[model samples]
Target: MNENKLKSLTEALTELASAERYEAELILKADPDTVIAQTVAAVRRSFALDIEKLLTEMGFLDPTTPEKCRQSAEAGT
Candidate 1:
C-alpha cells in the first residue's frame, strides 16, 4: 500500500482491535455465547478482505515471484 493508505488502514486496524476488545469484555459479563460469537463475526467482517492481495495491490507487501504475486492476490493484499 502507499504510505497514506497504509497509515489509514493501520489506524483502522487499531480502532477495530480496540472495539473488539471492548466487545469481548462485554461478552464476558453477559456470558452469552451467541452474543460473543456475533461480536467476533462483526469484527471479522470489518477486515473480511484478503490481506496479502490488499498488501500487494496497495504495494505494501512486495512479492518475489509470480507464485508469490498470485498468492498475495488471492490473499487480498
Candidate 2:
C-alpha cells in the first residue's frame, strides 16, 4: 500500500479506538467468526505494513538472500 493510505488508516484506527463504542448489541448479532477474522485482518494489515516499511528503510532485509533476512530477524534488526 502507498504511504498516504497507510497513514490515513492508522489515524482512523487510532481515533476509533479512543471514541465511544457503538451499540455493541447490534454488532454482536453478526457471526462471531466473521467478526474475529475481520478484526484480525484490519489490525494486521496496518501494523504489518508499517513495520515492514520501516525495517526495509533501515536495510535489515537482504532481498536476494533468505538466510540473511532470517539472520537479521533473529538478531533483532
Candidate 3:
C-alpha cells in the first residue's frame, strides 16, 4: 500500500472537517454508528485495503501496537 496516500486521507479528513462542519453534524446525527463505520470503510478502501486485507490486519488492532495502519480514535479528549 502507498503509505503516503493513506496519510493523505487523514489530511483530507481534517480539511474536510474544517470546511464542512454542518454537513458532518447532519451525517453524524442521522446514524452515528453507520456513519463512523462507513467513514472507516472508505478510508480503508481508499488505501486499497479490501475485506480480505482488512481481516488480515485485524490481528494488529490494538493501541499498544502503533505500527498498524488502522487506528482507534478518541473524541472529545
Candidate 4:
C-alpha cells in the first residue's frame, strides 16, 4: 500500500482499538471469528507498512530490509 493508505489504515485501527463498547458489541454480533481473522490479517499487513514509513520518517530504516527497519525503530524507542 502507499504511504497515505497505510497511514489511514493505521489511524482506523487506533480508532477501533478505542471504539465505544456499544459499537464493539454491535460489530461482535456478526461472525466474530471471521471478522477477527480478517482484522488480524489487515492489521499485520498495515503494521508492516506503517512501521516502515515511521522508521523512514525518523531517518532509521534503510528502505531495504524491513527486519532491520523494525529493529532500528525499537532500538530508539
- Colliding residue pairs in candidate 4: none
lDDT of each: 0.67, 0.56, 0.52, 0.63
Best by lDDT: 1
Better of 3 and 4 by lDDT: 4
lDDT of 3 at 11: 68
Candidate 3 clash pair list = none
Per-model TM-score, in order, reads 0.44, 0.32, 0.27, 0.42
Local accuracy of candidate 1 as per-residue lDDT tens digits, 1-77: 36889797687657656866776788778967667767777656654444444556666667555587679999999
Candidate closer to the true structure by lDDT (higher is better), 1 or 2: 1
User: What lDDT is reached at residue 46 by model 3?
Assistant: 43
Model 4 C-alpha lDDT versus the unseen true structure: 0.63
List the lowest-lDDT window of 10 residues for candidate 1: 46-55
Per-residue lDDT of model 3, residues 1-77, tens digit only: 56765665556556555645565567788898869777655544544433233334443234344333335443322
TM-score of 2: 0.32
Model 2: how far residue 43 lies from native, Å? 0.9
> 2 or 3, which is superior by lDDT?
2
Question: Model 4 segments beyond 4 Å from truth?
Answer: 1-30, 66-77
Worst 10 residues of 4 by lDDT: 16-25
Question: Where does model 1 exceed 4 Å of error?
Answer: 32-77
Clashing pairs in 2: none
